[model samples]
Target: MKKFLVPLCLFLASMAYSQDDLLNSLDSTQVDGKTPVTAFKALQIVTLQSTKMAAKKEFYFVVSHRFGTVKDGFDSFFGLDNATTKLGGIYGVTDWLSVSLSRHTLNKMYETGLKYRLARQDDHFPVDIVGYSVADINSFLEKDQYPGLEFKHRLTYVQQLLISRKFTEKLSFELVPSFIHKNLYNPDIERDNQFSFGGGGRYKITKRLSVNLEYMHNFDKPDFYKNPLSVGLDIETGGHVFQLIFTNSQAMNESGYVTNAAGDWGKGDFFFGFNLYRVF
Candidate 1:
């Protein structure tokens, strides 16, 4: 019995030592240094959604405004007399997925969308890729105004593949291949389907300030509609971001803004606008 007790004690000591060694090894383990590179600092590069997304459990509120075109000059106070406003909210379900809902004053449009990150910029991937889907509904369209207007005619859909890369600490670029489908259109005046390519970039000038430019070109669009061009300055302060923008697009939603913009940049028809956003 004494011999057995001695061996049992020796075995217990060996087990305790091994357990301590295992814990020590775990405590000494180092974190991986190859963390993925973040592309854009903000959730949006300008009017276009950026490859970056809201972090998990985070929410963002955005208020956007675009006044009438400066073509009206002082009569409209450089387009301030008529303003299109949008209120939007986005919530992150996970680190790489987010959903958003927004309402715009123009056309009384309501939009809902989902954004998902497909590939992140890391040691293995050179660019960040994201997929975005949006549905826009125009509620102000009255059947009385246009006889035979169907309910499905009020809906438009947009799908895009967003690809971007941060080339330097201060420079980031993005490209979006977009498809827009509208159910209602004046057959001779508009097409049911359109394709567009959007490009944008941001140049950081200061720690909290950036210069952004965005443009979208639609293929086979009507001669009356011009492509949209926007230039803006982004200001970041704590949990708030303010964008001072100049744009040729008064419509806020993807389908309307991309396919139906009437303002021409060459004619000085741009409008002054701003977007105030906050994260909570």
Candidate 2:
């Protein structure tokens, strides 16, 4: 009987130790905060990681076509020949900052420009500000001449201040105070070095579609010509953006539009323009 009793007690003690060991292992796992493995959890983690990487970079491209009547009175015999094409690219440097470059070809006229965002909207600032500079070169000007025709070669210089305010997720407005300098214009043609206080807005019609309207008025010389206004629509899909527009100004670049615009909508001159973009 004594032997049996001792064996029983030993068995019970061994079982108790085994149970304690199992509990201790579970407690250690909980304290280390290790999640249990599950198929769904694993997939959720992978999807989250992929989403984070995808948010890092974005790209876009666009091309546009413009046609209108030339206001220089050459259209009577020249057949109202005003047409242009524009190509553009935009890169997302960060979620809030972006840079863009665009090139325009208008018959013999070629122009290019760059835009940069210096500040963005935040809790403290309600408006976003941007700086832009554009230059127009008359390829038609003779380049071989010594000293060259500085006035003719350097067509226009435009510096602009852009202020944009977003009123809602789908609506926003912008104002531009622009200064323009032209070196080639005939001195006899009463002109002003400063031109165009512009304003425009964007209305989002859909998730990937929006319409924009912009206008510029030259306060320095309102009598020089008529104010230039542009209305356009943009379609954004993936890495591509398509812009369709109409305007009284046929010049593609800022310089040409500010200094060389020869169209007057009041006189029945208008143009149709479109842009197509793709990014890799």
Candidate 3:
């Protein structure tokens, strides 16, 4: 599956490149050489990716963590005993296109993804449209368990269309249509291909602080698992965007969280986490 990385990136990049002519024409939308920077300040509205992208030639490093359920007061050290971490880096291939790679402690997951902007919001456009796709490999699975398990079985793919609108400098909203495919799954438990729709928004509290909310609903997952609902606070400081999070989903990857959100909000099962990004 690693062999598909270059080809997949090239394919998506080409598609983004094809829209260059239209984007160039839209350059006139800028006023006094100033175009709106972004609907949101960070690369993510919460766990879900935002419409933001790294600038041309810029690179971003991100580290994220989600601790165990905070329901247990101090038994688990406030969920500190069972925390998962993800380290990732994204590079801008062009201002409108980017490539990313990340590794997570949970499931030993390795993720490779591409993000491209199809259109940027402006006076003529009502919203920003960005396409993001990711392929994750779970290296935690061992062949000893399932002799039939092949490398292909370890792969999971996700696709999302991020549509966002900035109604004001202090308010912005996004809608996401997401799809996930797992190469290995139990026929009795859930379908191999799953779909979901979600939306998120951010409200600025100050020049450097904002409150964000994100929720996702899976259409095909078992009824036992609840949809993920997350709330977070974003703080901007120089080159760093620091986010403090509270969510019902323990799995941070798109597919993992989408399909197997473990906690239930009704029971006060919540996980605390943070996502930090540094740009260079």
Q: Judged by lDDT, which candidate is best?
A: 3
TM-score between model 1 and native: 0.86
* Model 1 worst lDDT window (10 residues): 19-28
Candidate 3 TM-score to native = 0.88
RMSD of candidates 1 onward, in order = 17.4, 24.1, 9.3
| Pairs of residues at least 3 apart in sequence or in different chains that clash in candidate 3 | none
Model 3: per-residue lDDT, tens digit, 1-280? Answer: 3563475455334434332232223223465455753688789998999998887898887778899998997999889888898999999999889999999999999999999999888767788999999999999999889899999999999999999998987899999999999999989989999999998999999876899999998999898788989999987654346789999998878998878888888888999998877666
What would you estimate as the lDDT of candidate 2?
Answer: 0.53
Give a tens-digit lDDT track for model 2, residues 1-280. 3764485466434433432222113112331244211111000010010000011255555455566553445644222355556666656566434455566666355555445656555455566666666666665556574345665545667787777666776676777788888766555664538667766777778865677777777765545566677677765444233466667777666655654455667775666666543443
lDDT per residue as tens, model 1, 1-66: 376448546643443333222211311333355447666766777678889788788888777888
Best by TM-score: 3
lDDT of candidates 1 onward, in order = 0.81, 0.53, 0.85
In model 1, where do residues sit more than 4 Å from their true spots? 1-33
